[model samples]
Target: MSARETFTDRWMTAMSHAHRLLLKASRGQLGATLGPMKVVELHTIGRRSGKMRSAMLSAPIVEDGRYILIASKGGDDRDPFWFSNLVANPDVELTVGGVTLLMRARVADAEEKAALWPRVTAAYGGYSRYQEKTARDIPVVICEPR
Candidate 1:
């Protein structure tokens, strides 16, 4: 792993551990927060273990009854593990602001991403930076009520 990737992996691992603890303590009421952005917990079935796994994520765009997730992996070249899990099994559960719902996830096509990218970057400028730092086309995932 490159220095950047190593750093990000460690940071994200620590954050995920803390976030998991906080979610348990608060009944999913509280966790990571930043600049008015919405934080959510995504529940997915592990592809290899067939067990449930949870990851804390930021939802920069939630509109028209859908939630948007950016699979930037902290600008790393590879997608996040949660992204792979969701792709392997689209059935998911999302908890936002202490409210949980059953949802299905789909990766946005190029056209859909083209439309949403501007708004996503507008919501949080870091996304643009993330894109610049990575060679992969960061995926945009839409999660709608199931």
Candidate 2:
């Protein structure tokens, strides 16, 4: 990995750990939400390693019992590793508001993304900025109860 990628990975790992710690320490009273978005702990089987991996991510949009995730990776050129993992294994576990649920994940198709993009950007303008920063198209991931 390049130095910047390494740093980004390390920073993301550290933030996930800290977010989990906050949720645990607060007994789900705190850290359950980020601004208007809810925090979800997503667990997916690692694509190559076959081990379970977890990431703390904010769901910018949730509608019709589905959680929408943006694989922006802070606008990195490459998609997030967790996105790859889920693509390899669609079955996933999601913890939201201290409750865990089994969910299936998929990348939204072009039409879906086109429709959801506006809502996502409205929810968090940072996402628009993230997209502008990268050449690769950011993916919109949908997670629904399995």
- Listed in order, each prediction's TM-score against the native is 0.87, 0.98
Predicted structure with the largest lDDT when compared to the true one: 2
Q: Give the alpha carbon lDDT tens digit for every residue of 32-109 in model 1.
A: 455656788899999999999888898888888899999998788889989999999999999877778999999999
Residue 86 Cα positional deviation in candidate 1, in Å, after optimal superposition: 0.3
* Every candidate's lDDT: 0.89, 0.95
Could you give me the TM-score of model 2 versus the true structure?
0.98
Deviation in Å, model 1, residue 51 alpha carbon: 0.9
Q: Candidate 2, residues 1-146: lDDT per residue as tens digits?
A: 89999999899999999999999999998899988999999999999999999999999998788999999999999999999999999999999987888999999999999999999999899999999999999999999999
**Candidate 2: which stretches are off by over 4 Å?**
none
